[model samples]
Target: MDLHPGEQILFAGRPSWRSILGFYVLGFLGAIVVGAIVKAVDKTGSGVLAFLVIFALVLLVGFLKRIGTTYTITSERLHIRRGLLSRSVQQTKLERVQNVNTDQSLLERILQIGTVDFDTAGTDDSDFTFSGVANPDEVVAAVDRAQRLDPPAAS
Candidate 1:
């Protein structure tokens, strides 16, 4: 994570650990219930094996996705970097920011985690989504403050 000249990070964080912990709790419980039903019906262990395989793959993906992602808000821009096997970096200048929004689904609200979305000027779609981050409103406020700063003139 390098910054351009004079660029300073205001807020930097990854997704909440609480959400991942909650998901793991629910996922294991659901898998146990499903595996139990499959075990009763199938004489062989094929159903259990299948469930285990799928569950493992899902966990692997979630783990990689969670660990590989980084979200950053800086004085000049909002930056997102995602993925390990395949990487993508996206940045939107603060001066171009049109709107800032926060969304929390029922579960996310309960968990006190949500996504902060950035809408940059001239883009119909959201420019960035800082998902599953804690204190989304705080992040939104930081972004607002950053956007208020007079953007440096482009060379």
Candidate 2:
């Protein structure tokens, strides 16, 4: 199913707030760990503060990048567009898809969201992953439907 020339959109649903929250929580934990390590080694309050500032900056950039990123399932293929400075666009045809996997962490389960990983035939470490997707079951169903409608040809 080929998407029309200019018909791309985000995933079927919006990103889960729970996903965003989890990202922030992880960022906070990372900041703490980095700060602690710096403090233990350097024994300087300024080093910890510097680590905290740097961690916060990295997290902020990641948050903005996540917000800017989008996943599009077109009639023909799945499209992922992301990044600011070094933008990347990946498109995988439905017929080329070999497998699909949905994963949910304990936190994702509580939040009712997960990530969908796409495995395309003949690809080398180039699987497409849709992160922070809401209602992963629905996304999986959609992917299955797409795959069933257009299975890959035998090699």
Candidate 3:
């Protein structure tokens, strides 16, 4: 990530590994089932190869999705960058932040992962969020500190 002159990064991270545990688990189970069916039908050792390939593809997809997205909080703004080849960036100044919210599902709570949402003023993009982040409270604190360190300019 390139920072502007004098821009100080407060928090920067990608989705936690634990956040994608469900994907891994599901893929593993599915691979096992498929492998068993193939082995039963073919009576050959190729089932093992099929299982490995399926599991590997799942892992690769999950890894790419997780690493392709990034959340960044700087003294001046909050930014989210997504996609690898075709990049999309969303950012808003600290002064424009209208609300900060944390959302967690039951599974996410168990895994200790959550999404930190930022509602910014005067923007069409209302879905800005740090999804699947670990330790959401820390992210919130970082945002608070950034805002405090560089308070909104006086009118």
On TM-score, the candidate that comes out on top is 3
Query: All candidates' TM-scores?
Result: 0.76, 0.64, 0.91
Q: Clashes per prediction?
A: 0, 4, 0
TM-score of 2: 0.64
Residue 143 lDDT, candidate 1, scale 0-100? 88
lDDT by residue (tens digit), candidate 3, 90-125: 888888998899999998988889999998888988
Error of 3 at 127 (Å): 0.6
* Cα lDDT, all candidates: 0.82, 0.73, 0.90
RMSD (CA, Å), each prediction: 3.3, 6.0, 2.3
**Candidate 1 ranges with C-alpha deviation above 4 Å:** 21-26, 37-59, 153-155
Q: Which candidate wins on lDDT? A: 3
lDDT tens digits, residues 1-155, model 1?
Answer: 78888788899988887658666776777777777778788869866885796678668767877888899989988889998889999887788887788999888888899988887888765547998999899899898788777776688
**What lDDT, from 0 to 1, does candidate 3 have?**
0.90
The count of residue-pair clashes in candidate 2 stands at 4
Q: Tell me how far the alpha carbon of residue 31 in candidate 1 is from the true structure, in angstroms, after superposition.
A: 2.7
Candidate 2 local lDDT, residue 152: 34
